[model samples]
Target: MSEKVANTFDGRLIFLMLSILLNVFFNALTVSTNMGSAVWTASAVNLAHLFNLSLGNTLFLEGVIVAIVNLILLGQFDYFRLFRNLIFIVPYSYLLAWFKQLFFAMGIPFLPIGWRFVLDLVGLTGVAVAVSLYQRANVVLHPNDDLPFILRFRFLHGSPCWSQWDSNIPPIAIIVVTAILTHQLFAVNIGTILNFVMQGYIIGWADQHIFPQLHHHLDFKSTLH
Candidate 1:
């Protein structure tokens, strides 16, 4: 390949690697938090297993159901494009469950239910910070991030100021509604609202700090010219 083409390919690979590392690092931190929301995702997998659903199938179904609801509420489907990000989420979910199982296997005492809930709060905050930083990078966002952008662009019709905070609403709403419905259907609440609040602040902070730095680093203004 030509030098330019080679560089383009290299850039894509670097972005993908960066994405995976960021996800894995945050996920590890989240698991360490031993939070309710983090544990809840593991519980979902366990429940699916009890019913004979393979891990892959369960993740796919969950994504599909959530994506559908998001599309319905936002009255737009562009968020479907974000499914590409699921390429990472599926594997990451399984790894998280495996990590939980490993802890059990190692005879690590489980946290009390109350402590787990507190951990959930911490984990949610961690997620918010991680996602906000990732978004500010303006690199390829996770599937979850893409949903909010799609909704903002489609529903707000480009009118809303496209800061990070304004862009996060759609994804946060989707998670909240999904958690509610999932609770109703399965009799298990996942505490998505709290997750949104914690993560939302992280996003806001990232927009304020990380995005500007990335813009300056990229010389984005020069690219526009």
Candidate 2:
């Protein structure tokens, strides 16, 4: 189909919904692999442990923090953007829990380390592909995901790799500080390093190949309205 057709309102909604499922499904797969989780999620888990907070609450707080950062990055305040950014997490969290349970029933936890790493690779690639699709759709996004989308188009000269790296710095810092405070680390391993190094490249590749017909339709002004 045409880029215009794929990005129409209905088309965008489809992309948004599919991307959400892929995001949570693969993210849950990654967690079930026990290889490591996304940097942001891992950081949230660490903070949850450090502060004795539930992971869900810690994640919600992190989303709010990122949403505020998004506003600052845009150089304006948009309550709708902030509200939707936070609201997206409510359903997203439930889906994640459900997917995690699905994986548990499938016995992902019992997989061999070699096979688990392989699943982690699939999960990482799936996540990159999903993010690429939804970001181009430019409908709605997790605030954390939106941060990189903003950097990719607005500031990083459309470099997904650089934007991803830039967006990851804060969470990396959080992980470091949490490690210092806790004297231990969790949800970080070879897979984590691979995700950190490779997610942008994978996303960049997906943008070019996965849905070559679909293109970025970034509408920052409209989003503010």
Q: Compare the candidates by TM-score and give the number of the best one.
A: 2
lDDT of each: 0.47, 0.83
lDDT of 2 at 9: 72
Candidate 2, clashing residue pairs? Answer: none
Question: What lDDT tens digits, residue by residue, belong to model 1 across residues 13-61?
Answer: 4534554455544444344444434223443444454556764455456
CA shift at 8, candidate 2, in angstroms? 0.4
Candidate 2 has a TM-score of 0.92
The 10-residue segment of model 2 with minimum total lDDT is: 216-225
Runs with alpha carbons beyond 4 Å of true place in candidate 1: 1-35, 38-56, 64-83, 106-109, 112-118, 137-141, 156-191, 210-212, 215-225
Clashes of each: 3, 0
Q: Estimate, for each residue in 1-225, the C-alpha lDDT of model 2 and write its tens digit.
A: 677677677777788788889988898788778788888877877898899986667777888889899999999998877876877777666677678778989999899999999998899889889899888877778888999988888898989999999999999999999999999887777878888899999998998998777777777345334
